[model samples]
Target: MRAARYLRLGEAYISAARGVLAAPDFEQVRLPFYGLLGHGMELALKSVAARTGWDDERLMWLGHDLDWAWRVTLSDAGFEVHGARAVGGVIRQLSRPHHAQAFRYPALLTWPLPDPRCALAAAEAYLTLVRDRHG
Candidate 1:
């Protein structure tokens, strides 16, 4: 299924971001790392929509709207939100008041970001839950 493929890609992106975390020049790539994570999560939610028989056009409409995609995913019966809090928090932190774009482009705002390790773990947990339940 496309969802499964997207899920795999999502994990790959998150994994790639995590690898960058261990690098000595973390600050240099910090922005890109957040972008990667946001993208990975976006794919996760879009992939879930794909699983629900939504076409590419519908998924495309979702764009980078993580909150909307997440809402759609949660509409599924028994989404098994084992680590929903963390993922939800990250989504909130990324989607509301600002957007994933901030991570990709320079912004005049400054705000605390979620810990990379914890964010990675939460992402993995969320993906695992989705895979186990629907992948």
Candidate 2:
């Protein structure tokens, strides 16, 4: 239940991000876009973990660590991702800034951004998988 909630919330954030990206002033709002995407990934991965019966305490331990969450989902829980490596590459790219609050805060640096489409696809698949298989 909690897992599905996280997945739904993650989808909402990503959907909001797409709206932000569509705006004319999108260049000036890049930070918000990045932040939303990172946070979305975080929630989606948390959903995967929670589906496996991990408690709130363990989930909190992960915090904003998208990479670890993705790892747990991919290798441990065995969620079927079409391009696991590529999706992982996207998660690892977002993990550092997200974990450090860099995306939400003003800790911007030369962040090597990955394409969100892969991550987005992976997240959607995760959401669907958890809802269908677990429920």
Candidate 3:
């Protein structure tokens, strides 16, 4: 997985999320789209980390940083920060200090379908961050 390819997938994930959210019938399709988007984002992150030869410690640090960013952004929007806390806890538990031989794609993929309002906010924020950073 090339870094550029991962970045491209990240972009596509964000785009797909935007498309799903912008549609009027999002409720009907949110689960699958969210799952796919989450999987894609997780893979993209792992891909980029692998391509960069990041040590497990670095990956764990990156996950922590992203979790912090997610928490801050969600808090700023008045959403319950517990979801971010849970995600962060999982990262702490799963990420190895040296290297993660097996990628944890399921971490984000297994998250329950978010409440519609929170999901919309999170999708918008996630997409915006991806676009601004990767675009």
Clashing pairs in 1: none
lDDT of prediction 2:
0.75
Number of the top TM-score candidate? 1
Over the stretch 1-135, how does candidate 1's per-residue lDDT look in tens digits? Answer: 777888889888888888888879998888778778878888887777788787888888888877777877788533548768888888766564235477766775476778777777777787777788672
Question: Candidate 2: which stretches are off by over 4 Å?
Answer: 116-135
- The 0-to-1 C-alpha lDDT of every candidate, in the order given, reads 0.76, 0.75, 0.46
Q: Which pairs of residues collide in model 2?
A: none
What is the full ranking by TM-score, best candidate first? 1, 2, 3
Query: 100-134, model 3: which lDDT tens digit per residue?
Result: 22222323333334454454455445445443544
Quote model 1's TM-score: 0.86
Clashing pairs in 3: none
Q: Tell me the number of clashing residue pairs for each predicted model.
A: 0, 0, 0
Q: How many residue pairs clash in model 1?
A: 0
TM-score, candidate 3, is 0.45
Candidate 2 per-residue lDDT over residues 46-103, each given as its tens digit? 7887888888898888888888888777776778776567667778888887778887
What overall lDDT, based on C-alpha atoms, would model 3 receive against the true structure?
Answer: 0.46
